[model samples]
Target: MHDSQVFFELLSENTSKEVWADSAYRSEENEWMLKAGGYRNRPLNKRAQQSNRRKSRIRARVEPVFGSMENEMGGLFIRMIGRARAKTKIGLMNLVYHLKRCASLWKSRQ
Candidate 1:
């Protein structure tokens, strides 16, 4: 929660109003902060509820992308030492992921 402001500030001007996050991000304070920042928080709830199921369904769509990035694209390890280098490595990985996704889509259209 301490670094929420920093993370929120990292969002670009074109970012959407809704922020999808996990259960760890849920809290009354965080909700107030998110609302104050003009964002609609969609963090998963810890308890068993309808919203929890909905959140899980939403998260399921993105899980495979990260799984493939880590397992197939070798994005799990950061070979760099410094923070800048680490960011660059992750950026490159994201680029590679996009390229691979494009290629897959192109092939599927054939």
Candidate 2:
């Protein structure tokens, strides 16, 4: 559930209504998310099940993102001299890491 809002925003921005996200987006407010009358409905076939499994795999990709943010970019807990400076530095480092990730993905695609 780390960066759930970011995950939601990425899904909404990148995917169309025709793509189903499996059982990951469930909420108390919206129980029947993937079971609704849209691309989310089960196709009653093996291929659809495989596709749903692949959709579920999308959640796994974020693990590497978190790993890089923690390990390659430095651990999560910051120990700076001042609170305000530490907060600002941490935000900058996070932004830098995200940009590096995007660039790496873009380069790999090309």
Candidate 3:
């Protein structure tokens, strides 16, 4: 989680002021750092308690999209060797997902 924040900051060229994470990301040091940086920390509590039910509902909706990507769109693994090749594969996978999603929407309207 820490490394990901650094990478995101580097790529975005801006500091992230908000983060949402699971209970595994809970830590006093992380919390302190986020607070000091004026970030809105949304990690689940140590006892796995959710602070907001709305967030949980949003996560429930988002998880199924990832599950569909892994199961239906073949995004679970990349057989390629290099980072560039892996990125290309994932990009194509995402393109396919979008195409299929659009087709489904069009068909539903028809």
Clashes of each: 0, 0, 0
Cα lDDT, model 1, residue 90: 81
Selected candidate, larger lDDT, 1 vs 2 = 1
Best by TM-score: 1
Candidate 3 clashing pairs, residues 3+ apart or interchain = none
Off by over 4 Å in 2: 1-62
Candidate 2 weakest lDDT stretch, 10 residues: 29-38
Per-residue accuracy of model 1 over 6-106 as CA lDDT, tens digit each: 55555444367867665566788777877898886454456646867888798898787788788888767787789999898788878888899899999
What is candidate 3's lDDT per residue for 58-97, written digit by digit as tens?
A: 9897787678789887667778889999898778877887
lDDT of 2 by residue, 1-110 (tens): 55444544565565566544434555653335434524454454788678768976986876776677788877777788999989997788778878998999999999
Clashing pairs in 1: none
Quote the RMSD, in angstroms, for model 1. Answer: 12.8
Q: Sort by TM-score, best first.
A: 1, 3, 2
TM-score of 1: 0.49
Give Cα distance to truth, residue 36, candidate 3, Å. Answer: 44
Could you tell me which 10 consecutive residues in candidate 1 have the lowest summed lDDT? Answer: 5-14
